[model samples]
Target: MAALAHRLEDDDHLSDADFIKISNLIGQQVGIKLPPSKRLMVEGRLRRRLRALDLASFSDYGDYLFRLDGLETEITYLINAVTTNKTDFFREPEHFELMQKKLVAELIAQRRDRLPLLKVWSAASSTGAEAYTAAMVLADMVAQRRDFRFAVLGTDISTDVLDIGRRAIYPAEQVVPMPPGMQSRHLMQARRPGARPEVRIVPELRRLVRFDQLNLMDESYPYDRDVDIILLRNVLIYFEKADQAKVISRLVGHLRPGGYLLLGHSESMIGTSITMRQVAPAVFQKT
Candidate 1:
């Protein structure tokens, strides 16, 4: 760890031109922008990749990344290195509160004729926390009334994080913010013989969520049926305005009429031309 940190601190090979090229490549492929202000951050993250490949500098890494064979194989590592996965269980509490207060209630009211399955897509679900949290709530609701069923799908561009999420074993600190009752009901203590103790999402909650690798920049999502609600929070800030509009439009096309779209509190649809109406701050309902 110390050696890795020292190598990261020594990454002075990220020249301005190399940074721009790398940043542009990431933006083109992932729709996430890394501006000049993020050069140091980009350098720091990619240094580990450089060390792993035994590359001497960012310039050689860029050359290798853009090479014919590198495009096919190295790009995965490149994207994994650059993508940010900062998340917590119930990171934004009000969104889930709104789900419990309004969305779930509406689903129950329409349970007679409407579809019995409530599909939720956590569209940039990093590490599965958001998706699991959604499952915990929906599972509890299902326990109360057996009239409806809910399934949560978590998707992200990072396969590495998706794998971790699929495993569902997290550091104990990850569940500390969860309410004691919820922690008990949805998670189980799993202690390995030689490893630090961890918490795993119980089998019931794990059954309700499925993770997939998805890039929001794609023209259309791979969903067979439109989703009932989408939790796409805290991801748009990484995109440029035009990219944000394009991604929003594509996501809107995947929502069932009257379904809700939740964004980060700091995000807005000010310039986007979409059919959604702002039902709450940073919350849009598809028309």
Candidate 2:
């Protein structure tokens, strides 16, 4: 039995057919394209799932995944395993800089007495860094101006990371890049000698943001009111161009006319069906 276990572990190779099958499943379900070049990465990530289920090989795992009973819950595990949740606070600083210097100023100047609220959406808010960062900026902007109010909605498909964001606690390294004043004002540190330090977002800042599980592939978003700013950064590159167009169109529909859309520095809307005109690098304004 020990020898059999060793052999099964050794036979964890993912065949080309298995890779294609898994890729198709991911694309059909989540709209993420796993091209041939990512075969190795797919294998490495799915290996953990195999071990968790006590499956012997990728082929066996594939069979089980497509089987009627396994189809329901395992797909959630598959997505959780395959979804990449890379994010950092204040990633791509220029977007936030643009918000602080230009976008917020314009919104504030245009605001009327009755409608003094600013609505921001962190569309792909992985682990809540981006949402909290936006909250920090908006909080500071409204600090002296009592009439100005703002709220941030952070959404992602990953339930695990959303839980972490809800906890509002993070490792020290994640908090290191934040400026001193922002850190002092918005975070409380938990530290002990000879132990790793952690940071928690203050309750005031936490109250300004909310997190939810949202899939961009859905035909429509869950928002009730049109948002003023949408941060859909770093997530478009995962989908095929056609899927990108569909997702972007749905996302843009949620934005209020004259609202702003921000994408990752590496992403763009040139080929997509999104009609918002580019006002700055990776920034678009809905006309």
Candidate 3:
């Protein structure tokens, strides 16, 4: 019965009004057009938002959002509400493995590269697992190297999860992929009396990360630093083709010379002139 109750939490259904209300709201804000077929997903994301915001129904919230003048706060609430953060520490081993051998050593050897930064913007960084995972990779690589230099920027649209990111804590299951040797060096495990398995990122590795808010569709982006790597993973599948192209163009525009774009294994930029050439199954290099 207890297991059944937990399963029920993942199961959600949206009403017609809610389907339209959320679809239009997200579309207007982030330009993500939610179609009718995705109604249930929108409902699931919004359910958490509704509970957190203490709103009764989609219609009521919609009216409130529509009437609201300052959109930043409300937008922050929506970003945190809509996205799912189900990531682990070593979720993608290949990319990190590559960085360990080539990127890390090179960055470390550049003695004159002061203020040098290597960033892999986990654009959809949810609960910060992905960003922290990347941070772990850099930390491990640079810890023994004498002249190492790096930083990771994790950005997301969700304010709620961003809060979780800043908190830098996670349940045991979510942090499992990390190995024991690296785990101790990278994460600070926490388990108070009668509490469950939880972990927080330690200060050393935490300093290497800077998390912030980002909207993929926004034209006037605030970031000016050139990124060495950009991880716009499975999140792009949610956007329409034209929107995907637009976002890719914007993301690629920020990549540094010879930097890489690491995408989800299933995502692609088949026909876009984002100036990136495919390097592997889901990896691309700026041309």
Candidate 4:
């Protein structure tokens, strides 16, 4: 068994047939396009699964994945393995700046007759960084405006990333991009004798944010229909144009009229056909 395990690890490359099968399923299910250029990356990510399943190679993993009962149970692990979760606190500083300087204030002013509770959805909220970042900004607003209330909902397709988001603990370096003074205010350090330094978002901020597993390819999302702001940033680049339109249309359905949708800077060109107008670079207001 030991020798077999060693030999299996040696045969690490994904066969062409297996690559096609896996890539097709990923596109169909998650809407992430896995071009041939991504073959090496896909193989690298799947090796961990190969080790976990004690499979000999990508071909063997593929065989198991396509078997009668393999797909239904293993699909979650597959998605988690391939879906990218590259995120940082305050990754795009300008978006949060807009939220803090103008968007939140404007939304609050528009709804002053009622107690305004802002609902911010980090639509592709990988590991909760974006959602928590938004929460930190809004929490600061609440510090001054006692009447303001907010909740953040973070959704992602990868369960592994969602679990990390729920835990709210990250390596100390990941918090460096956060605005000055916000770190000390919103994060709690976890000190141990010889462990790598880590920080957990403070309970006050974590209480205002939550994470859930949600695939964007779903026909409809089970979420509030009147979300005040939706941050669908840095995610649409993964989908084809058709899929991109479908996703934007679906997300727009959830946004209240005059609500805001913020996309990544690179994704600005893709939302022109939707029922929203660009009010700022990568920022759209629902019509």
Instruction: State which candidate has the highest lDDT.
Output: 4
Task: Report the C-alpha lDDT of model 2 over 1-287, residue by residue, as the tens digit.
Answer: 99997676666777777677778988987788889888877778888888899887887787887754686878777887788889999899999999988987776676665647789999889899999999998898888666688999999888888988999999888977788999999998776623677889999999989999988888888794568899989988999888888887888888877788898988965423467778788999888
lDDT (tens digit, per residue) of candidate 3 on 136-181: 8877766676355677888877776778888897787677778788
Better of 2 and 4 by lDDT: 4
- Badly placed stretches (over 4 Å) of model 2 are 1-11, 191-194, 269-273
In candidate 2, how many Å is residue 152 off?
0.7
Q: Per-residue lDDT for 1-287 in model 4, tens only? A: 99997676666687788788889999999999999999888888888888899876676787888854688889999999999988989988999999989888888887855678899999999998899999999998899887679999999999999999999998888998986789989988776724678989999889889898899999999999989999999999999999999999999999988899999999988867666788899999987
Off by over 4 Å in 3: 1-18, 44-75, 105-115, 191-193, 269-274
Residue 128 error, candidate 4, Å: 0.8
TM-score of each: 0.91, 0.91, 0.82, 0.94
lDDT of 1 by residue, 53-155 (tens): 8987777777786653576777788888889999999888888888888887875575465548898999999899999989988888788777788899999
Clashes of each: 0, 0, 2, 0
- In candidate 2, position 228 carries an lDDT of 85
**Among all candidates shown, the one with the greatest TM-score:** 4
**Which has the better TM-score: candidate 2, or candidate 3?**
2
Error of 1 at 154 (Å): 0.5
lDDT of 3 at 235: 76
Candidate number with the higher TM-score (3 or 4): 4
lDDT for 206 in candidate 3 is: 81
